[model samples]
Target: MDPAVLREDMVDGLESDAKGVLHDETVAVAMRDVPRHEFLEDDRTAYADRELEVLGTRVLAPSTVARLLQPLDLEDGHDVLLVGAGVGYTAAVVAEIVGETNVHAVDISRPLVIEARQNLARAGYGGVLVDCRDGANGFPEYAPFDRILLEAAAVDPPRALLEQLTDSGRIVFPCGTQRQRLEAVSADSEREAFAAVSFDPLLVEGEQSGAVERNRMTREDREHATRRAESRRGWEQEWIEWEESVGPQ
Candidate 1:
């Protein structure tokens, strides 16, 4: 099948299976125009509305991407900051909605950042900036973005990202560890839960590096470590206190 046909089919699926996740025409058009196959290593299942693991990170499903972006209210010429730009598929979609020149994406994994850059460039979106850095610390050089989308799950919206938004800017991210809720946060620090989603936690400084080290461990040991890491709780209260104390100024 032609890639265009596959893309349209994917869009059709998104519209039907989206469950109100894709209400904006701009977002729909962007999703249709951006070639998801380019960002993915495998083009055969590119349109399958399922998450595919790439570059040691999972690229979110199209439905999940729509859920994360629908609330941001993106517009042409809007500046967007995309956190956790795994392979740049979401960023490419955003670049199509907002101009490529106006979109900046960051990832904690340097290799992923490089791959994302190559993928975006190959897909004719070289203008979209892909940076290798800790996503928790928002890209300050381009402070004050109109929309910020965090593709990874976090306990709460990053304090730095909130501060980097324009007064009316909005951010969407998944909150919680085991039971995650997709949340949209306003510049004023108010948050609203929209949908439930399962996403990997945002990698912090040194976590990505640590993941590289864990490759040497046995499979069973790695599985055991992962379970232990996921079982820890109480991030919600900690996030609330942190928000109250340092709130968005």
Candidate 2:
């Protein structure tokens, strides 16, 4: 099937089932134009609504990406920062909406960042900057972003990212370790929380060593283990306790 047709099918599904999460026409066009297959090893599943693991990191589902982006109200010429550039698919989509030169993406995993860079270039979005760094600290060299999108889950907007936002900028991220909620926060500190989502917690430098080990496990087994872990009472309690101890203030 033509990739463009498949992309339109995907966007149509998102619009139909997203429950208003993907109402932006500009975002829809961006989603359609960006070649999602170029960013994944398996093009067969490029149009699937489910998330896929790329280079050991989970690339968020298209609907999830749409939900996170919708509240940001992206516009042309806006300077956007994308944290957790898993495979650059999301960044490419954003770049299409807000000009390639205006998008910057960062990931802590060097391999992922390199691959993302290649993927972005292959998709003709080479102008979007893809950097390998601890994304917790927003790229300060390009201070004051008009919009920030963190693909990974965080307990709160990192102080550094919040500081880097323009006075009227907005940021969207998934909060909570276990029971995550998509949140959009403005420079003025106003926040809006949306539907629950399950996302891999954002890891910082020196914290992703175990990710390699986990990826080494058989894919089916790994997925089963992940499902079990998310459902385990002890795991939930641990996150609750940790949140109580050190969650965002």
Candidate 3:
């Protein structure tokens, strides 16, 4: 069998599986549309196969990609963020769901970001922000995002990221350690708080979310705020007493 045609056939079969499990037809099209082989370069035969390792350096499961797309329930036009763009293959898929104008991707690897930038273009997903930098802090310039996806495993939830999301946006990632879980964090617009948070036992170690350090400062912040409030109250009382005698305005 020719590898090219075989690849297409395999993808066709994968598409069968996708259609059954995936509820969204648009997601199904994007799954079938983007040539999985282009994103995965080393699998001479993965053009149709479900899994591929890019340049023999990174491994990505086509099923995993498909699964992520399902729960996302992404609308056609949305402002989305991806933390670990890798070679940008997943980002490209996300770009398809969200469209090019509203997709933004970030990563810590320089070469990977460059590769992703090019791959996104090849995938016909232009205007995405694929940048090489620490994904730990999250992208602030594009704040208040609607959807944020963390691609890597984390030891904690990335705080900088949580703060950047629009109130009511969704953040999905794997969290926890020793026993990791896939979790989703959702904000509640009505209450101005997080309404839904689901944590599932992780399949792998959690990705470092940079929340550890911020969490460590929690006690200090509380103590500092308490002291400041007490001081302000004391000053306000003294000023009021003085004004009563001096005739206040």
Candidate 4:
């Protein structure tokens, strides 16, 4: 019952003809090398091809990880950004493929971000940077990433994330609401849709888990929205007179 052997069997299951979720041997090898147990609370179930909940976030199933990563077609030394770091398992797997120093991750939940950072460090991917930020804004400091992976679902790719990609960079995420499909888009706006999948919607500052309140009418939420609105231009801006609309109502 060695963890390494469990990893091998996990990869084998993913690669089997019946599943065929994984095709890239490079990615497969990386999955084998990453110790998934370090990121989850239950070490016994870490290698299982099932999702586990941690810190109110569902750690993506192994097949889902493979499905998301295979389309990225990652390369070593590539600068990669993961929008929803979750428990940091996906980021660790990505660090394995693209080199630890080249990986960056962001999450809206501060608790999740703290947990992810600790998990990554424990897994020996201490070089991967995990920060607390709204996934919609992305990690702008590390702009022009070679690839971006969004673990949350959105009606469309976040404009900020798309803008942060390198000229040839590609982003993969689940697109839609009630129904969703895994899709990837390149810098040029060309898109490809893959399997149907469900993911939690991307969250903003006030909507994150353990926030003071879910209502966006709070002072903090309004101020955050106002700041974001002020920075937006043209059709991108939602026509809301913040003070008049949400104040004392």
Candidate number of the best lDDT: 4
User: How close is every model to the real structure, measured as TM-score?
Assistant: 0.82, 0.81, 0.66, 0.86
RMSD of 1: 10.4
Better of 2 and 4 by TM-score: 4
| Candidate 3 error regions (>4 Å) | 1-12, 15-23, 42-44, 48-52, 55-57, 189-249
lDDT per residue as tens, model 1, 1-249: 788999998888778755556777888999999988998766758888888887678878888888888888888989999998788888998889889999999998888999899999999999999998889899999989999998888888889999999999999988899999988999988888888899877766667743555332544576898887777666634444766767789
Looking at candidate 3, what is the lDDT of residue 91?
75
Q: Give per-residue lDDT, candidate 4, residue 225.
A: 84
Tens-digit lDDT string for candidate 4 (142-221): 88899999988898898999999999999999999989999999999999999889998877777887888773556576
**Colliding pairs, model 1:** none
lDDT (0-100) at residue 193 of candidate 4?
94
RMSD (CA, Å), candidate 4 to true, equals: 7.4
Model 3 CA RMSD to the hidden true structure, in angstroms: 8.4
How high is the lDDT of residue 123 in model 3? 62
What residue pairs are clashing in model 4? none
Q: lDDT per residue, candidate 3, 1-249, as tens digits?
A: 455564555446656745444445676667656655566555464553344444323445555565555555688777888887766777777777778778888865556677788877776776788976667677898877888877655655577878888876877776554454455677552211211222222211122233234433555777898897787854566556765666857
Please identify model 1 stretches exceeding 4 Å from their true place: 17-20, 209-249
Give the alpha carbon lDDT tens digit for every residue of 113-186 in model 2: 88999999999999999888889898999989999998888888999999999999999999889789989999
